[model samples]
Target: AISRWPNRVDQRELRQSEIYKQGMQTRRRVLGDTHVNAAEVQKSSFDAPFQELITEAAWGHVWSRHNWTLRERSIVTIALLAALGHLDEVAMHVRAARNTGATREDISEALLHTAIYAGVPAANSAIKVVKNVFAQLDASGE
Candidate 1:
């Protein structure tokens, strides 16, 4: 259970919110249960609030929008993360891209576009990370 309104609603009621339910479903769909479980497992008291915030805000309010397909959102996120040198998130998103129906070629194209605006060096690093993620995925037969 989680509480978006920790001060107002109890944890059970918070989890019952349409926003929270939709967010958890979307998060599990886009990110996968394994990754979500890992994060939930590792959550500490200090970071639990932050985790809930992202799950509700980022996944619920923003990601749940019907304006764009999940594939489109994943592509945009990959480009932004690569451009910003958020290599860790880049890797995570790259791995999750498949769940969103993003092919490796799509990710490559996104990174290539990022190079034009985000710089060749950033794209270069992201390319390396992408290759590694693909290799891991391939090995896992995912």
Candidate 2:
């Protein structure tokens, strides 16, 4: 499995290379160019390398995997992040859900499922956040 892409990833290859470029194209398409651009822009003199490393390792590496559907990954992410009370991360993933083919209903269920392991309070908060996002997306016809 690891042999698929090779040991090191070259972000530049995301432009010219087919497989690497395909993965990055998926990332940008799902996450939105603005969010991706903003993240890249924030990479300062010190944080630049670290930012590339994580994006390459996490977004480019793990998320780039073809084994799981983005929908499956998004649902799990929302639930786990909600349970941990990481609302910020939850919102980010919520935004990501659009790309994963995961609907609001899926997100709602994921948060509801979290109620079992996490407390009701966390689930409730996640619901509110998801609701707000739903409204926003609805307004934009997204």
Candidate 3:
């Protein structure tokens, strides 16, 4: 006969887990240190839980998947962000797309493809955001 086991965990230990560490690194790398730092600095009691959730769940589990290169992920992220009208996130991902080695032409094509399904207005606004991001990148010599 087998005995049932009780489930228990230490929350502090969970914070120091390897997966959390890896997710933090990936989040910083993809979103940039400045942006990540700002988010951390601005976190409040009300939002801290939500922040942790995304860091562990979105960055750690979803982004840490090895099925695609970061470049491909950036492209797909840009498309999804644009389609969903997450324009602010789109701007950030546009910068990340460049860092991930996705060319401007590739990004433009992705937006054009998004226009077909996500609607022209969304793509138009997204294109504007991308252009602004490109300008900033160029000015920074990135």
The list of candidate 2 runs beyond 4 A from truth reads: 1-23
Q: Which residues of candidate 1, in runs, are more than 4 Å off?
A: 1-16
Positional deviation of residue 65's Cα in model 1 after best superposition, in angstroms = 0.4
Q: What TM-score, computed on C-alpha atoms, does each candidate reach?
A: 0.88, 0.76, 0.86
Which of the two, 1 or 2, has more TM-score?
1
The worst-scoring run of ten residues by lDDT in candidate 2 lies at 11-20
Q: What is the Cα-based lDDT of residue 72 in candidate 2?
A: 85
| Higher-scoring candidate on TM-score, 2 or 3 | 3
Instruction: Rank by TM-score, highest first.
Output: 1, 3, 2
The Cα local distance difference test for each model comes to 0.91, 0.79, 0.86
Show pairs that collide, candidate 3. Answer: none
Candidate 1 is scored at a TM of 0.88
After superposition of all CA atoms, the RMSD between model 3 and the true structure is 4.6
Q: List where candidate 3 sits over 4 angstroms from the true fold.
A: 1-14
